[model samples]
Target: MTLNILSRQNTVLNKFIAQIRDREIQRDPMRFRRNMERIGEIAAYEISKTLRYTPRIVETPLGQAEVAQIDDSIVLATILRAGLPFHQGFLNYFDDAQNAFVSAYRKSTKDGKFKVKVEYISCGDLEGKTLLLVDPMLATGSSLVLAYEALCERGGTPAHTHVASVIASEQGIDYVTNHMPHQTTTIWAAAVDEELTSRCYIVPGIGDAGDLAYGEKI
Candidate 1:
């Protein structure tokens, strides 16, 4: 599987990692959220560097100069609640990019099994555009994949899709790699753990990203 795992080696990303990993820092909800946003910001820049860019003329104080600029339009989509801050980070960079949101919840069956139900999806047409789907955690990978499917079902399929996350389990990464359109979609994460809890939590993950970012829901 061609999985991209970013971590401490990338100094800028490492700072965000330290903050998120620090017990005391994680305790501060605002700081915790900001850290997540910071990670997103760094990730956004890194991803942008790889995208197709073309020379464009820009007016300077003295004269116009040619500079590289992103060519394809981008559509930033995030899972609700947890994804808000991370999404905001990408939005900070792609100010003019289209925005999209998806809400998928886990439903437990009578037999103790669970399934992902995509109840809400808000997106513009993604045809011929770049799609960035942000989810803070990737444990079971069901929600992320389902969210992608939901987006394509509602809007048109994207030319390319990029999945972003703070932490992911090895199994979760494998699941996405095997299920997603590998040639057109790529997965990016700061770190990948080896185990997943029975409850579908990544081991040593930053806890429930939604709860940590926005308090607990009743």
Candidate 2:
């Protein structure tokens, strides 16, 4: 899979990322959510460059103009709750794109390990379309891979898949590399961290994106 790390180049995106990781700034749930949205918008812009485009003529009051229009059919899918705002960012750009939502969470097992459970998925036909799976955090990558499998099982396989994450662990990236289709899949992250805790949380990562954006769960 092709990996694109946006932080590799210096840009204003880095400021938003730094704020999200800051404890003081995280105190403002509104700011945290907005920053996430900003990051998503930036990612959407970058991802757009990889899509196919075709030239089209447009009618104007003065005369006629030709513009390049996107030709690929896009489907934007997100893991619920945390991905809501991030998905909105992509939607802000690909407003006409189809949308899919999946509800997946980590379920604790008796062995103390956890398994990803995909309880619900709402998607339309994905055959031959480009699928963008946006998730805010990628720690272990199990949820993302399982979400992709569940989506394909229900909506049919997409022509191409773009996985977007705000923060990803190195191990999680490796896991996705091995699990997802190498040739057809691309991974995009705003930043990548080196460590993951035993419970599968990225070190120096923005803690509990869902909780920070919304509220703490019981």
Best by TM-score: 2
lDDT score for candidate 1 against the true structure: 0.87
State each model's CA lDDT, in order: 0.87, 0.95
Q: Which numbered prediction scores highest in lDDT against the true structure?
A: 2
The residue pairs in collision within model 1 are: none
| Residue 176 lDDT in candidate 1 | 93
Query: Deviation in angstroms for 209 in model 2?
Result: 0.4
Candidate 1, residue 141: the lDDT equals 92
lDDT of 2: 0.95
* Model 2 alpha-carbon drift over 4 Å, by segment: none
Model 2 TM-score on a 0 to 1 scale: 0.98
The residue ranges of model 1 lying beyond 4 angstroms of the native Cα positions read: none
Model 1, clash count?
Answer: 0
